[model samples]
Target: MEHSMYPSMTKELAKQRSDATPEIQAAFKAFSAKVFADGALPKKTKQLIAVAVAHVTQCPYCIRGHTELAMREGATEQEIMEAVWVAAEMRAGGAYAHSSLALDTVNQVKSRSGA
Candidate 1:
């Protein structure tokens, strides 16, 4: 039986992109490898951060990829969940931070209308 969209579609598409542009793909892989390497932060911590960022970006592929990498790098379920919570908080905080812009705009309009 052939399914319209299989569960592995994302992985298959990613592989296709890598095959289509091997050089650029290889460079990205290398860059990501270097970025995630253990330095001031450990590999597991970096993975957790990646997972959090993936959540903030709302990228399903990235979230799955980084969550798996995080687990492989020794991140516990609790750690992963905590990272997700942090992502949620940060997303909300972004909206909260932008409220200042809304406030300023409202004040400008009110002042212009002499209200």
Candidate 2:
């Protein structure tokens, strides 16, 4: 089997300037502003949360934005790295927790089906 470092984006089409209508831009800007609100949380906390959420969501744009924000908010390199690790741990835990439910379901199915 062929292995790739990242999920393929080949099927994902890039947008041209003409492809972006004014309404689309406005909507995107509004959504982003709402998600990354102004001063709703402490800058440092917000940056860390943003970084963690970015990692969890697997959003490269969010990760880059928040990594910069974290640095600007006086977070040390070590702190930023630790925050990413924390995100990784939480995401892995969530996956495992959910998988346990699936495992239980499989077990129940096996018992009922006499597999």
Candidate 3:
């Protein structure tokens, strides 16, 4: 079996982590429950958003967990794929937008060389 730098997320590991900090764990659980609860946005919508954000954040665990959750919350495969595309666009857009830094350096170098 290939071992990864990131350990597999198991319920036992989760319990061990939570056992180390029960109070914080409870608080985090409450926060997660509240965040996932239906509000102005339905659970399905939230899960889709989570899926997109997870992709952008590059968290494999979150991608799997939230993809499952999104499905459970009635998000279709098409919708989940759309969300991934959205994330891809946003991630690419960020790099595209930040290319201004390279442009700035180019202009600066050109000015210094009087070219």
Candidate 4:
């Protein structure tokens, strides 16, 4: 396996975490279950959204897990790729939109210098 910044998910580590914070773990599990359950948004749509969000969040584990869940929910490869493309655009768009801050600073400097 390739080396990763994140540690391997050993059972020992899982048990250690759970042993330390059993209540929190249980609450988190319940929250995740409720969030993923079918409601207004179907499970498939949720999984696809998860895949997209995972990319935006840059979580490797979530991306892989959600992509699999999305496929099991009948999301096609094309659909997954398209979702990724949407993520890419949103990521780029955030930077593009935030450029207004830099531009505003430049305008402030120009005004101060009377240029």
Better of 1 and 4 by TM-score: 4
* Each model's lDDT: 0.94, 0.80, 0.97, 0.94
Encode model 4's per-residue lDDT on 31-74: one tens digit a residue. 98899889999998899899999999999889998999999999
Q: How many residue pairs clash in each candidate?
A: 0, 0, 0, 0
Q: Cα deviation in Å at residue 35, candidate 3?
A: 0.8
Worst 10 residues of 3 by lDDT: 2-11
Please write out the lDDT profile of model 1 over residues 1-115, one tens digit for every residue: 7775435657788889999999999999999999999999999999999999999988887899999999999999999999999999999999999999999999999999999
Which segments of model 4 are wrong by more than 4 Å?
A: 1-3
Tell me the spans in candidate 1 whose CA falls farther than 4 Å from its real position: 1-15
The alpha-carbon lDDT assigned to residue 82 of candidate 1 equals 100
Predict model 1's lDDT versus the native: 0.94
Better of 2 and 3 by lDDT: 3
Error of 4 at 59 (Å): 0.8
TM-score of each: 0.87, 0.66, 0.93, 0.90
